[model samples]
Target: MKKIKNIRYPGKYGLLWVIALFCTGTIAFAQSGSDTTDTGMAEVSIELKYTEANNKTKILEAAVKTKVEGSWQGANGVAVQFYRNEAAPEQLLGTVTSDNNGVARMILPEGEEKNAGPEYTYIAAIKNNERFEDTEEEITVAESAFEMTLVEEDSVRQVHISLQTSDADGQEIPVGEVEVSLFVKRMFGLLPISDDPETTDENGEVMAEFPADLPGDTAGNLVIVARIEDHERFGNLEFSRKINWGIPLVIDPEKDKRQLWSSRANAPVYLIVMVNSMLVGIWGVILYIVFQTYKIVKLGRSKAAADTV
Candidate 1:
């Protein structure tokens, strides 16, 4: 009789092991490939604004940002270019680098104030960056004017505002039935002074009663602002002027005298006294312990000498 050795073939368990090894190898290969391939350029955003402030100063501001891991972050140190009107004959206004907050600004020449056409188009662009693709933002604004005046009559204060738009021929025409706003510029933001939104009449003028009790700087100078906001044709327009209209602020002479938040030279009297007392108490306890130790050593020596005698 011939002896047959036991033979075992791979069953279901062997098949599962093979499939697991294949899957692991496939996952590792895919991960390694993804590490070398380009993940594509970052998503970028640009916001452009045209502002005309005091003395007919025109400014173009571009704010740049990039989306990272589903959140928007400022793209600092990015260079941005400003252009006026169309691309073919585009007038290169200026180029500026973004600050820490991703804001780049350019001040147009004083002559730009008179270059208003039927529609003003401003473009801000970024190009040839490794991290970000070529991006641009365009904003179209119409020529608009906002004016503010201060008047005081018979113990009553008033703010007068006017809104106007320019025609194709560059002539100023009053815009009627448009909402204008009055604001007082504060440290952080604009304070609305109007109880209800005021709209312009046929003459493109609106008046609001100014409050007499608003506090101002030491010189009693307050900035009054007139704004035409989000007009379909004109976009945003603003004008401001500083005038001696607000109430004078009264500063206390002793405001900086010996307070908790003051400098060390201006430390509070009670605090100084309390700290000094604690230090004295701690030192006194230490000195008393030292004297008691000295007395014990001397008494022990005297006892030992008497015993020896």
Candidate 2:
């Protein structure tokens, strides 16, 4: 009975307990709602777009954009990284702070220089604490520049001699219907001949034959004189050089004749003589036969005259 006297009003105690439970439940619900709201916010996303405006100088222009989806928003001050496949990894191109629309624009520097083929790649990234998220885009580097080189061969004949030309750029130039001519000293004298020329083709090449009549007995040394003019273009050029036309004789006449006649039974000259003599002998035999026939006729005539007497 004494311990029961210390207990306060039961209704008051029950009211306190009910209030405490309500407060605890409200706190729990508020925390869960806050977590749901955080999840509903947008997440950070990045995109990259690029274009190759001028390929000759190896230049590229790129546009970078940052976006947010769901619940996680992009943090301030994001960085973009540009990289080439064969180059060093993860280079920071530039940095920008995201705007209210959650987009960032950036221009990346030119990538490492390369030859011929596709050369570079790009990526956009945003750093959150110690973690980073990035988006990748590829870039193509075009071929190298164009170049041309010309090489002329030694002219074998007296015709208008021309060089063989080619372009490293691989562009074909028209060469047909072009004028080609040459002037050189006469084989026997030191007279300068003019008006030798040739036109080039789409391949920057020309081959013209010279009408020089080189004698077999003269020395094979001659001066080459040439003038090349592009009738359709603005360039006119002249070239002259001394070239050796004398080629050494490879065959010995006596040796060649001996080899040629080795299989024959008679010498060529002896065969001709024998054939001529046989023809003459046949003619002589025919003459003798005619003389004998005439003599026999004369004898018969004489015998007939005696019978008549």
- What lDDT does model 1 reach? 0.75
Off by over 4 Å in 2: 1-42, 54-77, 86-91, 96-103, 108-111, 129-309
Q: Estimate each model's TM-score.
A: 0.73, 0.25
The residue-by-residue lDDT of candidate 2 on 167-242, one tens digit each, is 3464433444545445455556444344444455555445555434542223455555454433222122335555
Candidate 1 regions with alpha-carbon error over 4 angstroms: 1-39, 88-90, 261-264, 276-309
Measured by lDDT, the strongest candidate is 1
How much lDDT does each candidate structure score?
0.75, 0.42
lDDT of 2 at 207: 53
Question: In angstroms, how far off is 203's CA in candidate 1?
Answer: 1.9
Q: What is the lDDT of residue 303 in candidate 2?
A: 100
